[model samples]
Target: MTKLTLYNNLKTVRAQQKLSQSKLAEKVGVSRQTISNIETGEFVPTARLALLLCLALNKKFEELFYF
Candidate 1:
């Protein structure tokens, strides 16, 4: 099985959008630590949450995470 790694372009995307972790968390309905964890590749988000993140970041899902 392919190990699922949490690969995130969150920091870059957030910077591009001029959004802080708190702001992004609020937009995505998650805690700031969740964004931190994702950005640090420490926590993999579920499909539902990934969709939420992609929407909040205004990015395609593939642009956010991949194998």
Candidate 2:
């Protein structure tokens, strides 16, 4: 089986938007650690949360999440 490497530039995007992890997490209804984990590829968000993140970040889903 092949391990999937999901790479996301969440940190970069967040910085571009001038949003702190805690602020982004609050907007997405997740803990700051959760955002940190996601940024570091330690966790994958649900579709709903993904949508919320996209909406909050003003970025397309593709821009936020990618392989």
Candidate 3:
């Protein structure tokens, strides 16, 4: 069986937008550690949180995450 792994360009996108972890977290109602965890692939956000992040980052779902 083949497993799907999720990957993201969050760090790069976040850097390009000049948003700090704390700032983005504030916008998404999460913690800096949560953002860090997502960036490091240590956690997968809930679907609602993912959409919130997409809105906060001005990115589409595909732009934020992929398999």
Candidate 4:
């Protein structure tokens, strides 16, 4: 199987929205470390979480999680 590469778009999206990691985490109902892990490519979100993130960031799912 092709290992999915988790890219760090959290920082960019947060910056664009003028929000902090904690703030975004609260909005997404996840821990700040979870956000950090996603941002650092240490964790891969589930399909639902990925969709939530895309919606929160006002970005496309592909844009947020794909290459």
Using TM-score as the measure, the top candidate is 3
Count of residue pairs whose backbone atoms collide, per candidate: 0, 0, 0, 0
Stretches of candidate 4 above 4 Å error? none
Backbone clash pairs for candidate 4 read none
> In candidate 2, which residue pairs get closer than 3 Å at backbone N, Cα or C atoms, i.e. clash?
none
Query: Candidate 3 lDDT (Cα, whole model)?
Result: 0.94
For residues 1-67, could you state the per-residue lDDT of candidate 2 as single tens digits?
Answer: 9887777889999999999999999998999999999999999888898889999999999998888
How far in Å is the alpha carbon of 40 misplaced in model 2?
A: 0.2
| TM per candidate | 0.89, 0.90, 0.94, 0.84
TM-score of 4: 0.84
CA lDDT scores, all candidates in order: 0.87, 0.91, 0.94, 0.82
Using TM-score as the yardstick, the better of models 1 and 3 is 3
Model 2 residue runs over 4 Å out of place are 1-3
Error of 2 at 31 (Å): 0.3
lDDT of 1 by residue, 1-67 (tens): 8775557787898989999999999998999999899889888888999999898887999897877
True-vs-predicted CA distance for residue 28, candidate 1, Å:
1.1
| Candidate 1's TM-score | 0.89
The stretch of ten residues in a row with the least summed lDDT in candidate 2 is: 1-10
Cα deviation in Å at residue 3, candidate 1?
A: 2.4
Order the candidate numbers by TM-score, best to worst: 3, 2, 1, 4
- 66: Cα error in model 3, Å: 0.7
Candidate 3: residue 29 lDDT (0-100): 96
